[model samples]
Target: MSIQITTLDSGLRVASEFMPNIETVALGVWFDVGTRNELPKQNGIAHLLEHMLFKGTSRRTALQISEEIENVGGHTNAYTSRDLTAYYARVMHQDTELAIDLLADLIQNSTFDATELEREKQVIIQEINLSRDTPDDIIFDYMQMAAYGNQPLGMSILGKPEVIAKISGADLKKYAGIHYCAPKTVIAVAGRVDHAQLLDWVKKYFGQLSPVSDAPIPPSVYKPENILINKDSEQAHLSLALPACGGKDPDYYAYSIYATLLGGGSSSRLFQEVREKRGLAYTVSAFLSNVDDTGLLGIYVGTAPGEVAKLAEVLREQLVDSSRNIKKAELDRAKQQLKAGMLMALEQPFSRAENTAQHLLTFGRVLSVAELIEKIDNVTPADIHRIVGKMISAKPALAGIGPKKSMKVWEKFELT
Candidate 1:
């Protein structure tokens, strides 16, 4: 099901996608996050505030927040990303009002108790430690740093230990009061939803949320670099990144097709050549990270210490070869894989709700499945060649963690 939207006088957006046969509904409130919106002292404030919301509100305690939803056989959750922080719920259709009211209450009335802040702070610090210990997880953070260099887009959302320790309850309240305004908020629902009823509930609970004056964040400036960290490991972790277009760019679809043909799945070039054929690595894949004003297209591989050089050379060879020799059959397979992935995502209520919010925030409207499929269908071999040429024409940001000898292979131009 596709979505319909209505904007409130308070500036909050309410959207719904109705699936008649389903008894459950998924709904969420999205914020137009100031991704680069915080001051230098406020690096991880956006994510810190997310954890605080569930701790307590003026109307209910933290346990009550969990008990209320679970008692009703519904689940509530939240997540923070580079550009957005969302609070979501999945519930039986009849319980939609309760879900909406609880979510609105959490956003508007969260009290940020001091004791709760101290406790949650430790939890997050532990989280930061856990991320550091996971080599695969930490490598992407390094990759982003190499991609955007000193910009907010490059900073880890989990934040630095010192910064998280410094964030206070008052800090969370101040940030929320300004950035979590009605204008920055969106309420999206999918599955067995009644638009009029949903709108009425939203207006009653969210109508009073006031708008805040916000200044535009400076666009991220990309200054790609190469970073390598020496460590003791069984395998060398490699991440190769190059600049790419944002969500709205005309070439975004073509870029997606290009990446798919390059190594998006097991049957794609990187997987087949690097793993299935020569057995150089167990995990080799290409992916895209598209955000508001800019994006990165990267390929990651984990290979043996002795084979790291071969893997790096092969990766460069595939990029250069595929840009010139991509065939129609290869393009067709990538396009079919991409289209099927999108269409299959539409059936899940959570995914539908996410797409509704994401599209509304990005394009100011939701794109239908038919529209998306048509775009994927139109990408051809020539389009892949042209786009891949653009992707591989520049010096890429290389990030790696392993023995210094093996990781250094990525810093040389011999592969080209």
Candidate 2:
């Protein structure tokens, strides 16, 4: 893929790829600051700000914002994560300029009306309530808390209801002013984009953004421990996490392959051993979460309450056995899966735009498809063993939610 990157006078970076065959363009502005940039009291403000920005701007009402985009048969949305927040749109190539203008208006001109603020708080509070009631969903948050404790990294992006209610328009404005500067932002576009014209549009629209750097991000120190939550669910939900390398670590690719081979699909060790063979769990999968400084390699399992302890034992055995005897065939399969995923993403404009933006923020450059595949290809059986060895040797953070009896089993269980 051909990608071009430019830095505006204001320090905002712009990158684009021209997909001449596609009729639509996917574009977005991404900020380096997110939940990790907030203080303890400001836990959920980043997400609240995401909703409020869509509520209204100085030049348009909230209805007008959605109306204009939809009138053109386009779509827009935003999301907040641990280390990034993004506002994005997909529109016909001819409407790319309009998308850019609308996004600019959002960051620069949002009014943050008090009435809108109160209404949106209730909306987010409902969202929090919904998440709490979902066993599989809330278990990850408990896992995060178990891994990172009370630090910014461990805090939920949704924040708490009491804190959300306390946040005011002025507080949002202050946070935005401190974190939404040009030096901490990236604008990316993919599919039928014109580099020169796009660069001109970015300069004209985002030139006024302050060049100041964002507030210092808090340290995301990993502190491993076990945590349990009592609930009345029929199935026991368990999340096991071991601290691992971050996005920038040389071992990132290796760790990703390790996760994929361990429990990523039906043919994976955990799925075959825990589900197909032993009938211990209905759902078993492994995943990786990475930020700038730290990461988590996690396995999630859902099973009958009576089988939760056996599930943990199976997980430990699989991990240990895989480390000692990871096969060449499985390693090759994992690499192929990862490479196919990257290639498939290349066909979608939205993925290209989002991945370009993230790569620029994380690595200060767009990694070529070739470079990425080569990294995955270089991972050997020894590398898989190395990552697995590191993971099982470290203390794992265990988080469980289920009936009282299931919770009791987890309380007495240790992964190592």
Q: Which lDDT tens digits does candidate 2 get at residues 1-416?
A: 59999997778899999998889999999999888887788899999999999999999899999999999999999999999999999999999999999999998899999999999999999999999999899899889989998899888999999999999999999899889999889999999899999998988777668898847887887898888888887899999898888899999999999899998898888999999999998899999988977899999999999998788788878888887799989889989989998999878998999999999999999888989999999999998888888887888888998898998887765545
Report the Cα lDDT for residue 224, model 1. 79
List the pairs of residues colliding in candidate 1: none
- Score every model by TM-score: 0.97, 0.98
Question: Each candidate's lDDT (Cα)?
Answer: 0.85, 0.90
- Measured on C-alpha atoms, candidate 2 has an lDDT of 0.90
lDDT of 1 by residue, 275-329 (tens): 9999999998888887867888888888898898788778889988987898788
Q: What is the lDDT of candidate 1?
A: 0.85
TM-score of candidate 2 on Cα atoms, chains taken together: 0.98
Going through the candidates in the order shown, the clash numbers are 0, 0
